[model samples]
Target chain A: MVLDGIAKTALLGVEMGMTLVLVTVGLTLIFGMMDVINFAHGSLYMLGAYFGLTVVSVTGNWWAALLIAPLLVGLLGGLIEYFSIRPLYGRNPLYHILLTFGFAIMLHGLVTEIWGGQVQNISTPALLDGSVDLVLFSYPLFRLFLLGVSIAVTAALWLAIRQSDFGIVMRASAHDSEMVNALGTDVKRVFTAVFVLGSVLAGLAGVLLGTSQAVDPGMAASIIIQAFAIVVIGGLGSYRGAVVGAFIVGMLNAFGPTFAPQFTDALLYLLMAAVLLVKPAGLFGNPEAT
Target chain B: MSVKDIVGRHFSAHAETDVLSGRVRLGLFVAGVVAVLFAPVAQMIHPFWMDLVTHMFIFALFALSLDFVFGYAGLLSFGHAAMFGAGGYAAALLIQNVTSSALLVLPAAVIIGAIVAAIIGWLSVSARGIYFAMLTLAFAQLFYTIAFNDIPAMLLGVDAVTNGDNGLVGITSLTLFGMDTGSLMSYYYLALVILAGMLALVTRLANSPFGRVLQAIRENEDRVAFIGYNVDRYKIVAFTISGAMAGLAGGLWVPFNSTATTSMLHWTTSGELIVMTLLGGMGTLWGPIAGAFLVVFLEDSLSAIGNWEIYLGIVYIVIVIFAPRGLAGIFQTVRSNPHPKVLLSRVRSALVTYREKVFS
Candidate 1:
């Protein structure tokens, strides 16, 4: 029985971790490329979910919605980058922060205007609808699928970011965009691409999350706060740090209720606080950057 | 020259004009206070406006507290509502279970607020810039979650407190110096007096040597630290002071609303306070009051329209982009100019140019 409980908890933790990883990776990437913290990332994630729901309702195909929603959100992200964020580059970080915050409020307002202020649910596809039986316990096939997809995506992204020629330019621009521009690379285009990619990942996470939970406007605020914590704990701009931080936060969320239910919510923040106290730059972040 | 040097030069050039305008502003402020004080007796204004103004004063105080840390100390806290909520909850609990005295509940709330701020500041002060802001945000969300969720009695072996999401209610009315505090007029006057006192105190603190150090830290932390001042200690103190003031605002808020909820501690509340500070102008004590009035008034007026959030968002974007110094800066410019046409023409030309670019 104890072993069964542990397995269940571990599976739940992995599922939660996957959701967090999806959200945090985009946030970290955006911060890494452009020193701007995208406060509206959560809203973008919600938009993705809402867009996916709309597509599914219209076409009656979950797969089509998954592909289309991310693309649509990514295009919207590119537009936002051009119109709002582009002008604020090289200014104080505060401008981007406030601008994104305003964008978030606007997005939330848009979401409410279109969908109405009600909790929304997306039906899981028939293929991944039911739980699969295990020796000791059964787990949701959808959750397992999510875990697999997250792992595959993370792996593919890791390879693409670390190995590709484009990855080299990305890394170099992150270090010194001015130098990269001097070197004949179109740094502004690179930034827009990174921002769009980050938005795409956020949209993907939103769709995945929508399948499992009730979608609401407030979801963005709650999820973004946790994602921010994960980014900070993992170290801003560090991909590996995001993965590690997500897992830590995910497991804590899964098991904390059993151990210290009263303080479970506070535990992640306390951990973040302790990390800030000991290593302000975060575990995987560069000390000099902080 | 550095940006600071340029700003310093601009301020020096306007020093003579500033003194004259500053007096005018002060006189206007004093007149406004006297008007509010006698507003109850005048009986011309509706009770609704009285309530709105009272609430505005509380939020104004809250925004000023934020400005102390954000504007002066250069620390942008994304979770300021934690301190505000801490004060509100503390005061609410005290009023419900302990005393109805304003003297006791208010001070306790302020002290509790300071303690909470100190703890949060201790944890967050190690990081600089956006990291610090994120840390504060994380901590605030943690508090909000705890307030929102119900903990099982079996887990803590105690009854669930905070009442989960429903929030605490039935806070008894405050009594100050044997006055009937239940009346709207009395409550409004009391809040006005407290706000006035706090405004004076904060203004004095801003002009003091300690406040100057905080401003210095805001401009250049490394330079301030290099000069042998403990920058972290200064930041923590400023944070604590800001928290205490926010707490006082919260304490007043609970009684004014006659309820305290988990939403008070929510991140959106913190966001609203930031908007208020930014709209009025950061780094200015009186500007936050203007901001608070603008936000509350707009919220009150526009809620009937049902699309207020869109308007608020657009306003924020426009202000951040074009008027980063905010409404206060515009007032300053208007004060310095001999004619309003210069400002109007500049704005008109800019708008025309922007329209051409967008259309083209």
Candidate 2:
């Protein structure tokens, strides 16, 4: 029975780990490329879930909304970047921090205002509705589906960023935007694409999260803090680091509760603090970046 | 005109003017305080407004302390609530366990705030910029959880410590020499005296060599380090001082509300102080006070309306976009203008040009 419980816990950990990996990778990509610490990343995720919820409610099809919601979020993100964040470029980073934070608050407030403060739950798709018997215990099939989706998404993203011509441009821009611009690449277009891509990833996470757990007004702040912690732990701007960091956090989140229920929530951050103290540059952070 | 020359000319013009206007500004500051002091009596019919002003002053202290870290030290702390919460907890605990003497509790609150700040400063000062901010925030959240979830059971038994989520109830009223003078009138006066003393200290410290060195560090930390200053030590000290002052505000809040809760230590509380400092204008001594007043008033009046968060979010967006320097920045521009009307016109034209060139 104890062994069964442990296996079940490990499975749950893997599923949670996948979700964190998705969110952290998107955040790291944005931060890596722009040197912009996006305080609004979680808001984008929340928006995705809300938008997905709205779509699902209308069409009564969860999978369709999951696919479409992120595209819409991506467009909105591009517009936000075009208007609000552009002015703060080359200014004090505090300006960016405040601007993004203000944007986040506005988004959260709007979400709360439009859709009352009540929590909304999204049912798992019909195909993944039941539990899968895993030897001695049963686990939710939808969680396994989420894990599969996340793995596919991560692999697809890796290939897209590594092999495509656009990836070449993106890498060059990330290394030195000024140099890329000097080389006559359309830097603005590249940045817009990257920003939208990052937003879509965040939206994807939100859709998956909404399906896995309930959605509510307060979820934005909670997820954002967790994402930030994940990013920090993973080594800012390092995609692989984000994946590794997310699993570590996920397993800790799942198991820490059984040991120290009260301090369970804090364990993730404590891990981050320890990691940071030991490796100030993070697990994957370039020493030169700091 | 080159950028350096223009900057030099601007400073030279203002340098002489400041010497002449110091007395005027000081007089105005005093007059402003006096008006605030008399406001309750003048508006005795509206205790609601008096309460709002009182709350504003309490928060203004919080904002000012935040500016010390943000504006002066160039550190954006996410855990400033540590000081604020520590102060509140200290005062509440002291009131409950030791004595209800306002004087004793007040000083004790500051000491408690300082100790908490010292601990946090030690942990956080090693970091810079966003890392520092996030770490502080993480620590602050941990502190909040400890207070809200863990402390009640561990420190004061399950029902004893904070009264749980219901919060500490029936805090002892302020008594000076066994006289019950703990009315709103007295609280207002007490807050005013404390605010005045704080402002005086801030001004003195701001003008002191220590303050200049801190500003220099803000401008160029590497350069400051090269000049043989212990950069980290100075940062720790400045952060500790700011934390202590925030705690002072927290301590005062206990009597002002006659209760203290874990709510005082939440990230939202820290965010509010940041907003106040930003709104009032960072770095300016009185800017935080003004910000506190404006934000508190806005929140108070707007909370009655549905979707006040939307309004606040809109306000924050607009201010950050248009008034990055905040209200005090506007004051500075007006004060500096040789011809205020012409300057206003020039600003308007400049805005139009900026819209055409960049924003639009």
Candidate number of the best DockQ? 2
The fnat scores of all predictions, in order, read 0.52, 0.34
Candidate 1 local Cα displacement, residue A235, angstroms: 0.5
TM-score for each model:
0.92, 0.92
Interface RMSD of 2: 1.9
Please identify model 2 stretches exceeding 4 Å from their true place. Answer: A287-290, B1-24, B27-31, B34-37, B155-166, B338-360
State the lDDT of candidate 1 residue by residue for A1-290, as single tens digits: 99999999988998899778988988888888888899999998998899989999999999988899988989999888877787677778877888899889878887888898899988899999999987889999998998988988888888888889887788888888899999999888898899899899989988888988878888888888888888888888888888898999999989998887768778888888777767776788862231
lDDT of 1 at B96: 84
Q: lDDT of each structure?
A: 0.84, 0.79
* Shift of residue B75 alpha carbon in model 1, Å: 1.0
Q: What are the DockQ scores of the candidates, in order? A: 0.46, 0.48
Clashes of each: 0, 0
